[model samples]
Target: MRLTRGGKQNAKGAGQEMGGPDKEKLVPPAEGTAVPNGEETAVPKAAEPGPVTEEDRTRSEEGKSAGEGGQEETALAQEDGQRRPDESSLRSQLEAVQAELKSALDQAKEFEERAASLQAERDEWAEKAKIAYEQFLRARSDLDGFRKRTERDLEDRINRGKADLILALLEVLDNFDRALEAAQKTGSAQAEGVQGAYASADSSASGQALQSFIRGVQMIRRQFFETLAREGVEEIPSPVGKPMDPSLHDAVAAQEGGGEHGTVVAELRKGYLYKGMVLRPTRVKVIR
Candidate 1:
């Protein structure tokens, strides 16, 4: 058999020319230029220069960021400088406002305290005035009571004096009546004639003459009796043939021709009372 040159061969018998190209010796293309069919070529570009390695790219980015950061920091510093004085002015104004508010609160507290003190003083004065007024009213009431008591005492004294005078006058009248009765019983001609003459005269003329003669005495007696009557003086019940009451009557002696043991034959003297109080008891003759 005839063997060709391109025939499959064993690894041990293969020549050095049969191996693949060396990858380690291969070259890359130059900047901005395309490689030819099988050869690498280099070309320059007009754009900005690119980083040659990883470390060069990182350093270029850091420089660009640092420049931008420096410009921003300058602007922020200017803005802060502009606002600092205004902030200080605002803080000063706030402090002044707080001081004014504190002063106003203090003044208000002082006014409230003064008002409370005034109100307390007014209440105290009102209480004192009320007490004084009550005292004045009590004094007036006491004065009125004293005046009434004094008036009552004076009236009682006057009444007692008038009652006593009236009693004396009544006794005198009783005696005169007895004298007249005795004269009537004696009845002598001369005495009868004199009595008749006295009776026949005009009663008005004789009464006027008698009243004139005893003017002073009668006037005193009449006034005394009127005063006693005004003071509630009164005569006790007395009539002919009435039964005698031991409580109101003074028995002088036993009488004849009476109906029973308690019979009142005659009244010797009248009884009197002042305001339900017995002034004098009736003197009488009672049948046994």
Candidate 2:
């Protein structure tokens, strides 16, 4: 029995060694473990993320610059729109000034045309007045010439009438001279002696009266001849010895005579000249 008991103990000891739990093993804690009251709660752990690359940083900066540029362009467009109306108004004012200048030039040209026409009319009137004055001067000269000619003709006619009146008075004086010459020739023939005695004895008482009368008549004839000679009445020369001048003599008869050709033979009636002009030609006989 002792041996058998020892074998069992040994067996049990081996089993015990094989079947015992390990003393080094961990145990789970209780659900409400106590912590310090003032301490903060536990933070969640951050998840692991990707690293920053060069291309991602560049894209972010470009987007920020483009937004700022868009704002500046919109402001400049508004300012250009405001200035457009002012430029249009200034162009309209310049066009109006040019139209006014053209109107003034047209008015000045019209005034010049009117002035030229008035000057031409004045020159024409002045020329006409000068021609009229020249015509009046010519007419005055012609009238003066006619007046002088008329005065000269009137003076010539008056002188001719006075010459004709003087010629008629000269003819009456020539006839009175012939009567006195004939009475002187008869008285001289009676004065011869025989005829003188017969003429004195034939008178009776009346004869004595006639003899006294005859003597008285001889004295009257001598006185009349002497009075005429003193007063520029003289006989033309009719000599028997000289040649006959036709200007002073009228031949009553022709005869063969003692003198030369065309000589005076005898005087029939005496001729007289007054102031070297013939009053009457002498009547005479001439030798042919």
Task: State which candidate has the highest lDDT.
Answer: 1
Query: 1-288 in candidate 2: lDDT tens per residue?
Result: 112333444544554566552233333334575546744445433322233334444544554465677777677767766666666777777777778777877777877787788788878888888898788788777777777777767755653453344334334443444444444444444445335435655434444455665556556645654555564445688656577788888888889856677888888777766446565678888888
Write down the lDDT of every candidate, Cα atoms only. 0.68, 0.59
CA-only RMSD, every prediction: 15.0, 27.8
Pairs of colliding residues, candidate 1:
30-42
lDDT tens digits, residues 167-260, model 1? Answer: 7866875655555445434433334444644565565455555445455455555665576678687778884477887778888878666487
Q: Each prediction's TM-score against the native?
A: 0.51, 0.31
Q: Cα deviation in Å at residue 207, candidate 1? A: 17
Candidate 2, residue 16: the lDDT equals 53
User: Model 1 misses residue 125 by how many Å?
Assistant: 3.3
Off by over 4 Å in 2: 1-232
Position 164, candidate 2: lDDT: 46
Worst 10 residues of 2 by lDDT: 44-53
